[model samples]
Every structure is written in C-alpha cells, then in structure tokens.
Target: MEFYGKGNLWNFVEEERRNMHFTRSLSFSTDQNVSEPHESPFVSPKASSASATSIPLSPMSPETPWKLSPMHASPSPSLLYHCLASLHRYEGNVFSIAISRDFIFTGSESSRIHTWKRPDCTEVGHIKASSPDVRAILAHGRILFTTHGDCKIRVWDVSVTEKFRPKKITTLPHRNPFFLFPKKNSHQHKDYISCLAYNDGEKLLYTGSWDKSVKVWNIFEKRCVDSFVAHEGHINAIVINQQDGCVFTCSSDGAVKIWRRVYGESSHILTMTLKFQLSPVNTLALSSSPSSCFLYSGSSDGLINFWDKEKTSGRFNHCGFLQGHHFAVLCLATIRELILSGSEDATIRVWRREEGHCFHSCLAVMDGHHGPVRCLAASLEIEGLLVYSASLDRTFKVWRVKLLTPEKAAMEELVVTNDQQTEIEECKMSPVLSPSWVEKKIQANHFQ
Candidate 1:
C-alpha cells in the first residue's frame, strides 16, 4: 500500500512533466495546423483546436498561469476595449439601443423607453407610451421615433433637460376616426414593426415590419407617404446612407435590397438586391469613410458578410466575410472602420477592417451577458470608442475602448490567444473526477 501510494504520486508528477514538454513542442507548431473555417475574423484561423485528438497550445512557459491574461485582446489599433458599466433592469428584455447627441436610449418589452446620459451612463429619464410594448426606438437629433408591438409608430420631440421629457408629436396614419374609417386603408402597418431607419436629408422615416413590407413616413408631415412589399419573409433591419439617400433593408428571407428615392419625388425605386447565403440576416451596418465604404450584414449562421462599394460602378460587391461567433449575430454597429457584432452566443465581438484593404481581424470578444445580445450602438470618442449594448438578459452595458498602436495590439492579441490555448490544453490534461475520488466512491458503493 505504501509503494502503491508513492508510485501513483510519482507517476502523476512524471506525467505532468511529459505534458509540459508536449505542450512546449505543440506551441511551436505553425499556425497552418488550424483548419476550422469559423475560428476567427481573419482569413487564417488562429491557434484554435484543430481536431479532437490534436490540441494547439500557445507559446508560453509552463510556470505561466492562464488566468493572468485579459479576457479580450486589442483590435487593429491595438486598442483594448473593456466594459465600463452595466445597467440592469427586471422590467423586460431590452430589444433595441440607440444613441443621440446626449442621451442613449434603450427599448424593451415594456412601454417605457429608458434613457441614460452620455460619458457616465447614468439613468437620466424615460419616455412612457400608451402602448404596452415598445420593440424599437430611434433618435435623430431631438426627434425620437418608437415602433410598438401593437403595429404602430409614434413620433416625439425629446427635450434635453436635466430630466428627459419627450413630448408626443403625432402617431403615423392619423388615429382621428373622423378622417379615417376602420374599413378604409389607414396606411398604417398591418403587422408588427420590426425595425426602423431614418433619412434626415429626405425627411423620411423607414419602418420594416414582420408583414414583409417597408413603409415610408414623411417626418415633417407625420403621415405614410409610400408603402411597398419589400420581401417575402419578415423584414429584420433597415439602414440608410445619408450621403446618397439610399435605403437598405434586410429580411428573414435571406436577402438585402437597396432603394433610392425618385428624383424630386416621394416615390422610391429598387436599385439593387444582394443575396449570398440563405441564412436569415438579422442586422445591417454601413461603414462609410472618406476613402472607403462597406456594408456589413449579420446573419443567423454567425457569419458577417461585408460588401465593398465600387467607386466608379456605384454598386456594392461582396468582398469577404468575418467569422467568429458560434451562433446567430443579432445586432451590429459600426464606427469608422470598426464593427461591433452582438450574437446569440451572448458575446460581442469587435472587428476592424484594414484602412484600404479587404482584410479584417477580430480584435476582441466582450462577454458579460447571460443571454443573447440583442442590440448595439457605438460612437467614436477622442480617446477611443464608446459602445452601448442591450441583451435579452435584461442588461445594458457601456464599454470603453482604448486604442493602441498596431504593433502593441498584435503583441497583445498573441498573448491573449496563447492564454486561451494554454487554458484549453490544461483542461484537456485534467479531469473533473480524480482516480482517488472514483476509488473512494467505488469502495463506498461496495460497502453499501
């Protein structure tokens, strides 16, 4: 018994020694060993596990503890983004997040649209509506537009005071019974309003609905000016290009279509259609810079497909895709060259496109939510960027991203990836139930 105990301990120690040597050898293995297609944002996969038998290890000393590394890595600018604050409410699942000049707005399953102040993310005020559920809220200058589960849209003028008080402007398709009858076509949406987009230049608000239609409302006039069937499936999201007044809509039918206003008229005409993967696209973001323009679509298959607009051709062409999330990407927001995607995997990933190139790299993965992340909003700051995210877990988070140089960011990413790989290797080497515990359990079972 004495020899058995000592020998077992010696074997364990020797096995650990061998494991350290094996891990070191594996660490030096080339990145070409990784073959998974969806392992990273970059074209080439990082040092993720290639298969069940072969595990990749990061280049690190045996004495290094895996927990010492930060959860997220710095992006292209080598900027490190970390969560600054979290806002929690048991009211209901937050469905949308929007940012204006001063306030950050979040809509939930409840009728109230919650507001938080900029920089500090302090709960400043809220807007209550007569409807029972507010599915989406959007802010343009001082104007607030809310879409309800009751299939209606409301306009409000948000007063920027110490306390936020939004004055009701008017509801679309005027509810006046004398002007419109129940049997008559009210021009209002026939089904639930799913998403909204606004064009300040055209003074139009575009609402996409589960009814598979897109409705255009004249903001100043507060009435539906045009309506059209946009897709065969429910419309999921819509975005507008301010420079050209082009509206882009994505639907559950796995298609994206672009529309342009007829010259000097309220009518619109379909300009283009983009459909690559059959996966249902949930969100869309258009990143337009002085030098480049790209449109990104997040879909149910966890792929972020982006299209680059041709300068001379004036058409968007499918360039490449960003793959990192393990589940459906529910929401997406872009600021400058950086894109933030919130997924059903309960993680928010940051990706940056090269200034003038087609290449993109996963900078970081921010995770704190216990449920699917639903909506995201981000804005550029002097120091870095500010990200506001809402999730089905009924939580809102504010993140501050600090930009670092490319060299420093690359080094930081290497360290983070190494830490993750090391942790995975460690998990593989260890078991939850030790032999000693199993032996004890077996003996107790025999006795019993």
Candidate 2:
C-alpha cells in the first residue's frame, strides 16, 4: 500500500543509520505539519501555565485540595515543572515513545528508532527499521516492536551498548499477505498501523490501524493468529486487562467497547459498549490497584470519561468525567492512584484519587512541552518521580513532580465538589465532532 501519512514527507537514508547525528540541531526533514486544534489561542500565557515571577495562591488552603489555583488554570508551577535535561533531538514530530527499566526509545518520521541512556540523557544508538515512518513502538525486554505506515509490524533484537547493532528478527507480514487476511473491500485496516498492545502472559500482540481492524499477532511466529473488526471508524488505541482477560478498544466512532477472551478459544466476544462521548475517543488506559481497577478514555473534545462496573446493568458504567483541558486529550498515564493526562493544549495535568473517593482533583499542570503533547511515560527516581512527555513540536520534556508527601495527601480532608456539568446525550448523526468536563465527586469503586 502507498503511504500517505504526515511522516511520509521524509525519506531517510537507511545505510546511514549507524552514522546519524546526535546533536539536536540535526536536520532530517523540512516539513512541519502540526494540527491547528493544538494551537488554539484561547488561553493567556499567565493563566495557561506556571510563571516564575507570579505569587503563589496561599498554598491553595488544604481544604481545597484538588481545586487548581489558575481558573481553568493548573496547580502552581513550582509543584511540577520542566526538567532542564530535556532535549530536542528529533527533527520531526515524535509520535511514539517507550520506557524500560534502564533506557528510553523514541520513533518519528525519521524511520530510525533512537535510543538514549537514562537518568542522564545521552544518545547511545539508532536502528533504522525498514519502514520510513514508525507510528507505534512497544518494548518488552531486548526485543523492540514497531508498527509503521506500510501496514507492517517489525520486531528487532538489540543491545544498550555504544557498539550495539539492531538485527531484524521478524516481520509480521509474510509473502502470503492476503491469504490469511481477506480483502474486506478496503474497509478494514490494510493500511497504516497506528498503535500496539502486547499481552505478555498470552504471548499475543494486538495492533490497531487506520483501516479500523484489530488483528492479533503471535510475534514469535511472525503470523497473525486472530482477526476482528472492532470499530465502525478508525481504531485509535487498544489496552488489555490481564486480571480479567478483557480487551478495551476506542475509535473515531465516538464509542469505547469492551471485549473479553473466549475460554479455550483463540478469539474474543464483545461484552458491552460504552457510549455518549461527545467526540472521537482517542486513547484508553486501565489502572489497577490492590482492591479495584479504573478505566479511562480520552477524546478529541478534551474530556475524560472513566468507567467502572455497576450492579444495575453488570457492565461498565460512565462514573463521571474530569475536565482541565481546553483542547483534545491525546494520551493518559497513571502513577499509583494519580492519573496524568497529556493534551493538545500543550499541557500535562496531574490528578490524584483518594483511597475511598471516585472523583479526582486536578493537582498540577506541567506545561513544558512546546507543541501538542502526544505521548507520556513515567519512571521512579530515587528523589522524585520522572515523567517523560513527547510533543509534535519536535521536542521531549522530562518533568519532576513533587508528590513526596503521600502521608500528607492522605491526612488532608477534601470536600469533593461538582462545579462543572456535562451529560451523555443521544447519539447525534453528526460528523463525529470531526475528530475532534467534569465536576463530579470522586468515590472509590471497582470494575470486576
């Protein structure tokens, strides 16, 4: 298939991968294709982010825990800010980023997956995958899996050494492409692969695509074992819950559906559908605590709807929504009981969930990235929590969030308040908001 993605503008020289430049000034592509929704001008510079000279809002008074000081504003900048260790290494938009125990990997329009030494940001190596545009990257050990615009997924074996070289261990599409995958009249995803999720225990890899199909692949065998049509529109993201063996997928269709594995069978069955989203669902994430699990979905309309099990229908219920962004919510990352979401507003808002509460309070907003925040990764530092965020502005920022006082956060009493209101209305026959709030109380619940 011919590639038409925004990454296709660059044609890198594969043979020169080992000799790629390490400086941020390196030029790989001349095209700068950024979406307008991320560049909205509705926020004043002071109200949108943290300021160095601004006075603090009396520490927000412990009683008003999650109420951010800024009015559609985020928490104080001092609580969460950008790390000076940030680097603008990529020449184009950094689409996908992955984090491991000791290293970080990022893929972009350059087709080469760049590796850097962690704790101290330094370029170590670069591997040129065959595909010129790598859309998604997920790492499981020494093995690196990447999806691209060619409708193909490739696996690589590599090392973290200065002299490390990447060898192409496997390619998903064999010679008999259409034999295993039938022609669905071009409605299905015979196109670019957008996102990927790996089930370590099941040894299965799930790939979502622009063609709107979720195909399960056995990475060890380089063969697609199972295939299913997940959504009526293009599939954006896929995440699995290992505890219950459930798979959740969100799409441009403005719906988030739940699917479960069939016992003794290789396929899955659709269980329930969660709808009423005002915009196309862009991403979904599942966070599990010792007692319960929480499901979060982000949309183009800049709202996040969380789902939990309800006894009334025995299906996932739209508990409530969280609102701190004025643009599309692009990605979400969970750190313990706290949820950190990145958005086209070019900010990352941090929210905390108390043990017994279901509603979350906005704690701080990290406005370090220059462009629309596309992806996020988190790790532990001996002294603080490190959050790595990638953006369309061709730069990545590392943040240091001060959540050191876990005991203080627990002792503090929060009077959960609902100041904003949005409802799920009947599905309108509109253009899905073209893809493309909550002031609800937080309560402790589970989705078993």
Candidate 3:
C-alpha cells in the first residue's frame, strides 16, 4: 500500500519494526526538495510526531544536572516544538554548548566564551580566555569549566548580576612560583582536552583528552589528583554515573571502558570494557532509574549502541542499537527519558526508551544546520524541554519540545491521516506542473 504522507510512512515503518523487534529501523530520506534557509519563530518537525513515542519520566539526575521545577504536562495530543531563537556570531564555528541554570554558554574557535539568557536567548556578555579555540565546556551550579586548544582547563565562578562576567577562579595544574620546572606529564594534558564531567558529591572534575588519557581534578585543590591512560586511541567523550562514582569513557580505539575509584583512594581502576563494533565511538550518555540504568554510546558509523546495566554484576551488557543518521554520530545529550543525538549529517534525532524494556523509538528528526552538529545541551522546562545545539556552521539554535502521551498521540494520528487524505486527493485531481529550472538545480545540489 502507498503511504499518503511522510508522517504515515514513518509511523507505519516504526510500528512494523517495533512488532518485529528490529533494531535497525528508520532510514532517513535524503532526496527531499531543498528550500531556502530561513529562521522560523517555531520549530517545524522534519518528520511528524505521529511516528514518535515518549516514555514517562522517572525523577533522576543526568550527568549535566539541571535545577528543574515541576513540569506541568500540556493537554494537547499533538507534539509542540518552538525555535525560541537562533544564536550566531562571526567567530569561528561553535564547537561546544553548555547549559547551567538559566544561562546558556557557547564556545567556539575564538577564545571568547559567549553567554546567552534563557527563553529569549539574548546575548548577555562573554568571558575572554587566554587561548583560542575552546573545545569543550561544562557548567555545574555556579562553577564553569572550559578547555582550550592549548590543552589547558580553566575554571570560572559564574555570578549573574547586572553583568554576566564570570570570575576566573583557577586553572588546572596550578602554576607554582617555587616549582618553575613542573612536570608536564604528571600535571597537564599532552593533547587537546576533548570533554569534561563533574561529580558533585565528591567535588571532583573529570577531563578526557585526545592524548588517550583521563585525569581527575580536585576542584577545591586546583590540581590534578590522578591520571591514567583510558584508551589506546584519542579519548572522545567522558560521562560519570553520579549515582555511583563509576566513570565511562569512549575513544577512537573503538572501545568504551568503565572506571571506578579504588575504594577510598584517589586513583581509578578499569572495571569493565565494552567493545562490540570496530568503528570509533565518539560520544556517550548515561540514564539512571531506580529500576534500571542505561548507557548509550554514539559511534562513527552513525549508529547508537546502548547497554543495560546489570544489577547483580554491576556491569553493562550489550542491549541493542538505534540506526538512522546517515553520517557519524558526533554528540549526545540526555534529559529524563529523552536521548538527543547530533550527527555529521547535520541533523539531530530524538529517541525515547521504553520504561521497563530495551525498546527505543525515534521520536523526531530535526534538520536545519548547514554543517555538522558538533555539540548539544538539554534541560527540562516547566511546560516542555529545552534543547540547545551548536553546529560547525557557526550558529546555535534553541528548541523547546513538548511530547504527547501514547493515547493522545494515537488520537492525533487519525486527525493527521484525514487531513493528509484530503490533500492527497486534491493533488490527484489537480493537473501536474513542472518545477522551475532554479528549483530543479537546487534539488540536484541537495542530492549531490
């Protein structure tokens, strides 16, 4: 049977995959006609929400914890997403995005770290750094951390007064006047710092570097307390399971390793290794619940592999994978039950995991960026969810997403089907028209 609308097409496919227990499901369409780029006040889903699925939220804190207020569900059956604003600057491509409290931070090839306010996404101020090309940024509570191309990490104390100037607290590998010849191998990263994670309970910071090592820093001490080689290749991403102090790191070596602190010592020891695919893993995200926990790793092959945390063994077992993106999966962000992935294909796919099973469904595919999506940040809003994505195209966009219950989604689908039917019937009765030469050229370029 022919599908009338793209919405129905994806929905039918997803439903079939769900029933068949298939992992490699959606194949994103790349042959759509091209349109001129324009900023819309609202977010239009590239795919309809009728094909989407959402799960209930269990009160849990993600790696990047947000101070969220109680969410009041919308009564609407259809999904709602708004493009609150698009933030852009002339600086080089945005490499990282971080959300802390009410402020959003964007780091780029420039030394300045730009800041924007929530809701409106208005520019406040920026913090100038000592070096160019800020690669990674992590903000927690009032403390903010940024890594530069110099392979140095800087810490800042953020205060939101009239001006958004954050004070420079200290730099990692604290410079000592007495010890002029400090050992670089023991103190500073040998290569670019790629990612950062913070453990609030221990007040410690984790930094993963392209030098294939992971370092633990004591926030108060302003020094690296422990360091170890994490992977055989460049370390790409690092995430911490705050519930337990277990740290997870992925690398270009095509491996994901788990590390745990040695009892009361500051050092860490490898607990387990997860390497199923030969492709390089680029990013990771962790989801925790009272009943079970999950670990998601995005790799170079444009597939997301997830693992189920075993309660008795305290190890992650390979569960399954999510397939959709046409290019490498570059970054991942998790909020509650939602998993958002940015890819080299310049699109973001939203996925929701079923409550008690390993089942996952692609909720939506968002496309707007002209280049690879480099980084992503997300937080829960009172009425919906806020997602911030920074792209290599030198722009960052804020999206507010609202999901519907399964019952509401089913009802909404019927209405969408009726509307689609009328449109299809009208097109059938109308005479066919040829597109203009310019439109055809644009479409040709899109496919090329």
Q: After aligning candidate 2 to the native by TM-score, how far in Å is the CA of 327 from where it should be?
A: 0.5
Q: Which regions of candidate 1 fall more than 4 Å away from where they truly are?
A: 1-77, 177-185, 406-448
lDDT per residue as tens, model 1, 62-154: 542222113332223355555677765444567888889888877877666776678777665566666645777889998888888668888
TM-score-better candidate, 1 vs 2: 1
Q: Which pairs clash inside model 3? A: none
Relative to the true structure, how large is the alpha-carbon lDDT of every model? 0.71, 0.64, 0.71
Runs off by more than 4 Å, candidate 2: 1-78, 159-163, 176-189, 310-314, 406-448
Sliding window of 10 residues with minimal summed lDDT for model 2: 436-445
Worst 10-residue lDDT window, candidate 1: 39-48
Worst 10 residues of 3 by lDDT: 64-73
Q: How close is candidate 3 to the true structure, as a TM-score?
A: 0.74
- What's each prediction's clash count? 2, 9, 0
